[model samples]
Target: MKKLTSIIAIATSMATAEVANAQSQYYKKAEQNPYTLVYDGAITKNEKGKVNIHPVKYKLNGIEIAANVYTPANYDASKNYPAVAVAHPNGGIKEQTAGLYAQRLAEAGYITIAADAAYQGASGGEPRHTDKPQFRTEDIRGMADYITQYPGVDAKRLGVLGICGGGGYTLKAAQGDKRFKAVATLSMFNSGEVRRNGFQNSQLNTVQDRLKQASDARAQEAAGGEVKFSGVANITDEEIAKTSTDLYREGYEYYYRTHAHPNSTFLYTTSSLLDLMTWDAAEHMDLIEQPLLMMAGSKSDTKYMTDEAFPKAIHAKNKELFLIDGATHIQTYWKPEYVVQAVNKLVSFYKTNL
Candidate 1:
């Protein structure tokens, strides 16, 4: 009787532990937000390019961000393979452009991961949609660490790709994290520069204007209100043409209409503008000694990022730049031709380097 009681007690404890692990492995509600989004898509499972999408969740800065893992067709747990960590743009999710890139890369024989950044998508963060540069950089590092431990992944053979704001974050990650054998970015945006000065330095050029906006934003926040932030979300057709900022129209078509997901929120705090002004990925670009591939549309208004950072990378020996002549910033996100070019370039770079 005593032996049986002890055995039952141990079994009960083990069951309890498993239940606790399952609950904690997934994200929990932070503050008042209790809902979460799960990507129920398929992933490749067969040699015919069948997909068997798997849910991947990992914690960064104490926030659990959701991710989708695409295992290549004919993926075998017995055989190890190289992997890529993909980061999406600000106000973007894994299902958008990142998913497209991840899928293509996986199809090309690499394990690819597309994750929702902190405070966005199915990721966990309080005060949603708050974009912090440091946290974003940490998110990439966290993904690299997670992928390294996967059953069939070769930790040493890893690379990273970031899109838009994610591109900037990837550059930042490469500067500090040596785990990534190579790094790449597409249509990168220096969020800090653009936030402080506006597009092409059109606004906040003067210290007075910058201070005025800061002061007003603080006052608004102090009055039990959120400061209004602006971007592609606030622009209209007339505004896009008036600015003549290259690729503004393409941005509108992606973020506002066709590819827009119902849960993707665009509102951000105006106070974050002050934080963005100080964010610069190029600050330590020279420190990154790994192979770097930077891609941007030749006519993209955001082309300046590629132009500036690419020239400043002094430590990189194997660096290349591809500027798509007819492509715009948003065009490369989903356009078949541009996507293929970007994915092909990424696969070639990783295969050779990693």
Candidate 2:
């Protein structure tokens, strides 16, 4: 018995040391990439008398939202300027692609804001990572409310750009929120369609079973039991290398490897699935009467989602779907050449519409 106890103690100490080492590694990397902003053109802090990044905090639906607002070069509060709101992707914060786009737009002379989702990132919310369709849509609307009131902003010329899951929610928000004079989506991802039907319908037969699991998770949370989390908690290098789909394989690489951000995570409460599985990105597409542009990678496995949603927006005043050649969904977020191409198209789209 004494020998067994000693062996267990040794094993426990080794495990504890390993965990401590992993944390130290994360913190060390974090110092090099503090703020977790990994985009090519990301800013470390706000600069004076130039295109600058302004960290913002505001209340939306009673939750304090964390965001970054980019002001145009030589900004003058006395003069009116056009504004745009850039929404981040799933498991994304303002510091990633959204901030990259926002900063690029600012250089193009448009004030822009990129915010973290309420229950995610640096934003304030209970039961962290509770992603619901309603809350996501509301977040887009909240950006409009705050930016329109910002000094030098012209509410009449406001526009919105949603990326990935943000793109999906933007479609829902723009369907009713006419305040957004122009709408654009980059690498659009339909959270609802994928959740309910599964990716490429690969898990169609297990829908009910997965749903029951979500329901049970919700019940447990309501009863004040142990909190349950879902989604990708951790992954091995070998597993990512062997992933079949480009959308996810490259995605795991982007979100967990090359451009990994400490604030970005793959987990969400299991109960969130209850709401996510029932929503559809294109349910009310007819209401978006504003000018619209949807861009995605032609080769993306998730391109089907954009293809499916774009055509349904027939009521939009002006709508165009452009597919990037030779790029994948995750590539559009960080690839220098692809990002430049997207920003150029966006500048043209916004200039013509806003």
Candidate 3:
């Protein structure tokens, strides 16, 4: 185990150092953000007069969940402010895109929080990498629970933004969680649908076989046998280079190479499929009565999910679907122009509705 840790450390350090050299001008200062791995426009602890980041932890269902809260510049606790909860994507933590969006929203004058899901990242849970749908949805609710009571937060003006798979769970969470006055999603990925039928419905024939695999894994646990796990355990640089899909290609670059963090992983327990395979993000979509804003890249292959889910929100009090022209799925996370457009739309949507 020690040898393995050293090897991973060497590899990740080498990767990040290369990135740092390519980005040498951005890191002229000695200090770094204590809470996040370096990425494009990542915040430093001092924030240099931008929003301030507060690293925090709170208990959710007996597990300690790690999160970062971003407050507006020159924040005044005496005055109430609108707040937003940003949910990270699958295989993501608070320090990645979630934190990026949280910080940007804070700069727009909204208090925002991005939290590591329990059992993932820096959060506490046994049998790490348990990616159950229910737990993920609860994680969003848990963020709302924590941020509403934060100093200077106006609970009545609360909003939420969920990215990728987190966007799917956010839809279900907002269906019944009334505290969030407005709900938004970016590049929403429906995990359950993909897990059951495979990406692009390419695995439609193997649905039952996968279900049996999950069932057997669950049975192993019941018998006190070895814990079975599944999912992408590792990726080769060559594989990433060879991949043709923009989503997977750029996703590997973002999560494993460029913006990699020790807490993120592509693995999850096989038993988690029991819930994930049966769930759908658009289920009970009519339950959401709050204002809604769903955005995605017009050129994203994953745009189909957002398109399918958006029209289902027929009963939403108010709703809009904005596509970032010419952007792909992963580009929205860090590309300067897309990120700027997303933040602009988000600021406007929240301001008008919240």
Which candidate tops lDDT? 3
Provide the lDDT at 199 for model 2. 80
Provide the RMSD of all predictions against the true structure, rounded to 1 decimal: 15.1, 6.5, 5.7
Of the candidates numbered 1 and 3, which has the greater lDDT value?
A: 3
Q: Estimate each model's TM-score.
A: 0.81, 0.92, 0.90
C-alpha lDDT score of every prediction, in listed order: 0.73, 0.84, 0.84
Number of the top-ranking candidate, with TM-score as the measure: 2
In model 3, the worst 10-residue window by lDDT is 1-10
- Which segments of candidate 2 are over 4 A away from where they belong? 1-30, 33-35
Per-residue error (Å), model 3, residue 91: 0.4
Ranking by lDDT: 3, 2, 1
lDDT of 2 at 174: 94
State the displacement of the C-alpha of residue 353, model 1, in Å, after optimal TM-score superposition: 0.5
lDDT of 1 by residue, 1-354 (tens): 112111001122122443334333332311112123222222323334454457778877678979978788778878999999999987788877887788788879888888888877888986666677887898899889788888799999999999998999899999989999989999998877666566676655453465466567768877978755534333333433454445555655465444555445455555655666667877888988999999998768789978888988998959999887688898888878878788888888888899
Candidate 2 clashing pairs, residues 3+ apart or interchain = none
Minimum summed lDDT over a 10-residue window in model 1 is located at 1-10
